[model samples]
Structure formats: C-alpha cells, structure tokens
Target chain A: MTPALDPVIHPIQRLRICALLDPVTEEEFAALRDLLETSDSALSKQLSALAGAGYASQRRATRGGRSRVWVQLTPAGRRAFHGHVAALTALANHAGDPD
Target chain B: MESDAVSAREALDAVSAARELNAERLRRPKRYWIMLGLMLAVFALLPYTADWPPLLRYSAAPALMILVAVVAAWRQPTAVRKIRLSGRMGLQLVGFALLGGVVIAVSRGVHLEQGWWWAPLVAAVLLFAFVAGVGPRMDRSWARRASHGEE
Candidate 1:
C-alpha cells in the first residue's frame, strides 16, 4: 500500500508524542512531558488532540499515594503511528531517487 | 524537495533516539534482578522441602511467591508504564520451567536423598546462578524489543 502521512500525527510535537508512546504499553503523563521537554499545558493539548482523533487515551490512577495520569495509544493510534512512520521513511528514501 | 527530505530523515532520527531513550528508561535496577533471582531460587528449592510438615512445605512457596509479587508491585518504577512480557521472555520462562522439571525428575529417579541429597541443592544453586547471570540480558532484550515497537 502507498503510505500516506497522517494529518493528526504530522505535527512535530504530536508526532514525537506518538513516537514515545508507541514503544510502551503506557506512560505516565509527567514522564511524557519530561521526555518531550514540553509544559504540561502544551503536552495536554497535544494529547487531547490525539485522543480526539481516537489515537490516544489517558486514565488517572493512584500510585505511591498520589494521583497520576497515564497515557497510551489505542490500537488505532498504533496503526496510524506506524503508518505515519512508514510514510515518512518512504519520503526520506525517495530523496535518493533520480528524477 | 531536498529540504523536505532532510527534515524527514531528521524526524526518523528523532524517532530512533526516542526509542533508545525509552528502552533505557525501562531498564530495571540490579537490585530488582537480585531480589527476583532469590525468589526464584527459593521457589526452585521448594520440592526439596517435601520432608517438612505439610503446612510448612505447601504454604511456604506460595507465600513467598505472593510476597515477591507484592514487593515487585510496590517497587515498580514509574518509568515502567506497564509490564508486558515479550515473547522472548515468555519463552525463557518456559525453558526455565522445563529445565527445573528435569532437575526434579532426575533427582527423584536417582533417589537423591539417599547419598546424593545435595543434588537438588546443586540444582537450586545453578538455577539461582542462571537467573542472576541471564536476567539482565533478558531484560535488555525485552526493553529493546518493546522500544522498537516489536512487542
């Protein structure tokens, strides 16, 4: 199949979020923010956008006597992220092709 | 077009770095493996405790197993979002079980308690060694697979 870029994941921050989330079963919200070096509000906005697109979801859980938000990609989100990566790889590889 | 390609390549590099970082974050501490290895060693030695009273022999292994589980949960790192055993780890566990079973069966066949009471003890020691030696490598392999989106 011809790979196509996903608009939802095309933005740099959102794409980075998906890249980080794709590896693990779930990640704590604060950890994600720390890794991405983005503020809570900005990370939340990006996550909300991904969640709105049905690509990601978050849940609140109490751990170590504190409430923490955990985020994970939905199955659809994983597929979309992988597809988006494949599209990017294709585009990058095409750079070597002759006109 | 050239600039777009450069950016795409850069983005892919970012993805690779993210995966590597995630894998590193998922790596467990040495203490975790030591505790786990000790627990597993005790579990392997349970069969040798058959001569003990029924209550002690039957309950000890299960109780220790539960304690291990509780400790593991309590000490789970925040970086480890969730524990999903990869196929390789699962296979390693199955292999451990099979090898353990063989040790028990051989010990029984030779009536280890007669003059070779140390057979099971040796087996338990070997099992502990296996865990201590191979556990970290298995964890590394699992982390790599998970980070690469292969799990």
Candidate 2:
C-alpha cells in the first residue's frame, strides 16, 4: 500500500521533532530543543500542534529538585510519522524512474 | 514534478540527518556503563552471601539493586536523549543473566566441594569485565539501530 503523507508532520520542524523522538521512550524537552536547535517557544508551538493532532504528548515532572517537561511520540504519532517517511521515500525513489 | 522530487529528496536527507543526530545524542557516558558494571558485579557475588543470616542474605542483593537503580535514575542527564532497549539489547541482557546465573551456580558448587572460597570473587571479576567491556559497545550499536528505525 502506498503510504500517505501526514499533514500534521509534513512541516520540517515537526518532522525533525518526530525523527528525534522516534528512537527514544521519551526525551526531556530541553534535550529536544537543543537537538533541534530551536527556541523553547518554537519547540513548544510545534509540540502543541503535534499534541493537537494526537501525534505526541508531554508531561511535567520534578527530578533532582528541578521541574522539567518530557515529551514522547504517541503510538498514533509514530505510525503517522513512519507513514510520512515512507511516502517521502516513495516520492524520492520515483525521481530516477522512467517517465 | 522534477522539483517536487527534488524537494522530497531534500526532505529525506533532512530525516537522515535528524536520525544521525539523535543517534549521536543517545550514547550514554562511560560513567553510566561503569556504574552498571559495578552493579552487575555485585549481583554476581550475591551467591556468596548464602551463608549469611537469612534476612541479610535475601534482602541485601535486592536492596543494593534498588539503590543502584535509584542512583542511576537520579544521575541521568536531562540534556541527553535516552533510547528504549531494542530487541537485540534485551536479548543481550537475558543472555548475560543466564551466563551470570550459571557461573554463580558453578562457583557455589565449587566452593562447596573444594573449599575454593575465592570462586565467587573470580566470578564477580569476570562478570564485571564482561559488562564493562561490552556494555558501551552494545549501547552504541542499539542506539544506531534504533535511530535508523530498525527493530
């Protein structure tokens, strides 16, 4: 089956977010921000978009006497992200095929 | 159409770069492995405690295990990304447990029959060596596989 591109994850920042979150159980928000090299508000905005789409979730926890936010891709979000990647792969691979 | 394809290729490259970055970030520091190895070593020596008071023998290992876990969690760096264990890592852990168990059992048997009191010591050293040597490598391998979206 041809994978469909997920509208919610199509943007570059959100795509990067999903890619970063894909391998981990969960990531600290600060870590994700650093990895993406984006401002906290920018990251939070993208995360909110994902959360609204049911593709991600975040929670706050206090560890070592400091409060921090952790984020993870929901199962639905993972499926959507994979599908988007597959669709992109298909599109890219089609470039070399005979017209 | 050609432009679309080019953009898609670029997007794919971005995905690859992101995954690579995540893989690099997922590596645990050497300290984590050292602590883990020490914990395993202690667990390896648990069999030698069998002759102690029943309360001490049974509770000590579990308590040590909990303490190590708490310390590890507390020390986890908030700036580094963490990866869930892959199937290969899980299998590696199970294999380590089985091997450790066999070694400890054999060491206990040897101590009983030959009075080789240092058998548990030998087992602990061997297990610690195995863990310290292989733990980091295994973590790196799993990080790579996981970032690349492999099982």
Candidate 3:
C-alpha cells in the first residue's frame, strides 16, 4: 500500500474552504462565507492559514475602487482536497465493510 | 499557470478517489426522466432547417444532467468525506458531453433522426459501466477500509 498519503488538512473550516475551492476557478468571499456558514473574520483566518500552507491562494482585487477578496486553490490545495477526500472515503469504506 | 502547476499534485491526489468512482455514481434527480424528456422534446421542436442546427438541444440533456449533479452534490460534508465528483469532474463531463454531441451532429446531420442513436447512449452506457464495474472492487478495498478506521 502507498500508506494513503494523508495530509493534515486542518480545522474543519479550512477543510471546507479547500473542498469548495478545489472545483471553483475562483470564488468570492461572500459565497464562501455562505457555504462555510462562518463569519468574515473566521473565514479570513482559515483562508490565511491555508494560504500559508500553500494549499490555497488569495488575491485582493479592487474593482471600481472597492476591494474584492478572491479565494482560490493552488494546484497543491486542490490535490490536498482530493487526497483529503480520498482518505475520508477510505475511512468511510473501512467502517462500512462487514469484513 | 504557475500557481496551477504548483498544486497539480494535490489536485490529482485529492480527486483520484473521485475519479475512481466518478462515473459509476449518480445523483437522483427531482424529475430526471421528466428533465430528459423535456430536453429531448425541446430539441425535437427546434427548427432543423437552420444553419446552426439543433445540436444544442441534443446537447442539453447531458448538460442539464451535469448541472443537476453539481447542484445536488455541491455541499461541504464534515467527517473527512470525499466529494462525490467535485468540480473538475463536472467540467470534464460537460466537455465530454459536448464532444459527443459534436461528433454525432457532424456525422448524423443536425436533424432529429436515428442516424447516430446508439453512439451517445452507448457512450453513456459504457461510461456508466466503467464506473459501476469498478464499484465492487473499490467497495471491497479502500472505501470499506476507511469506514473501519483503517485510514
């Protein structure tokens, strides 16, 4: 077995962030906030943590002189998201199997 | 693409599980048959006399299917759960569906006829089989293992 490459995908919120971002090109802060059901400060904190881990990327854009915070997955983040998912699945399967 | 390049490994590793079971799994729709029937009927109603043809109509069925799959599957599940297919698979399936349509439309002509009837359905069935066939093996393996705290 490959030892099932499991990365520490910390804090449920950050995990959710990676999950949502894994498939999206880029998502608005508000949309992510809605999905994660977390406050702005909390979401930002998780996002920043993910950014530091190189699992995610954050860009601040000013449109019409208003700041826009965009959250996206780095390729690493996407893979981590997938791997995280796979490990979870593996766990699920193990639990479900009668054998 | 630099940023894209960096996270490629994680993306691959993460969705590898999804890819493994992607095609085999499907979401139950609110009105799946109704949706398919409506799409086919709408495509049928389109004027085939036009130059652009009615490829879009034929193409709509799979598109709607993919859309529904995305919406239904779009959610965050705690407990380290893997997403069913995630976003990448959805986009790929869309492209695949479009490719199927283009090939059929070009070969069979845009008119609603039975020229390439088996192609799309066969393709779908084959894909479904590919996914479904692998299900048992996977069930016996990692998915089962994971559930038992083997991970």
Task: Write candidate 2's Cα lDDT for B96-145 as tens digits.
Answer: 77887888788878987988889888988887787778878987887899
How close to the true structure is residue B43 of candidate 1, measured as C-alpha lDDT?
64
Candidate 3 stretches with Cα past 4 Å from truth are A2-7, B1-151
Error of 1 at B104 (Å): 4.6
Query: Per-residue lDDT tens digits of candidate 3, residues B1-151?
Result: 3443334344534444433332222222323333333343333333332345478656755676667545544662211224234344456547655654554454335233655444444444444443344433433343333322233
C-alpha DockQ for predicted model 1? 0.67
Candidate 2 ranges beyond 4 A from true positions: B46-81
Q: What is model 2's DockQ versus the real complex?
A: 0.72
Best by lDDT: 2
Minimum summed lDDT over a 10-residue window in model 1 chain A is located at A19-28
Q: lDDT per residue, candidate 1, B1-151, as tens digits?
A: 8997888888788888888887887777765676667676676576677789999998988888778767766856532336457777678769977876786566555555475667667766876787777877877777788888775
Candidate 2 lDDT over residue span A1-99, tens digit each: 778778899998999999999999898899889888899999999999999999999999997799999999999999999999999999888887997
Native-structure RMSD, model 3: 12.9
Q: Which prediction has more favorable lDDT, 2 or 3?
A: 2
lDDT of 3 by residue, A13-33 (tens): 565566555534676787678
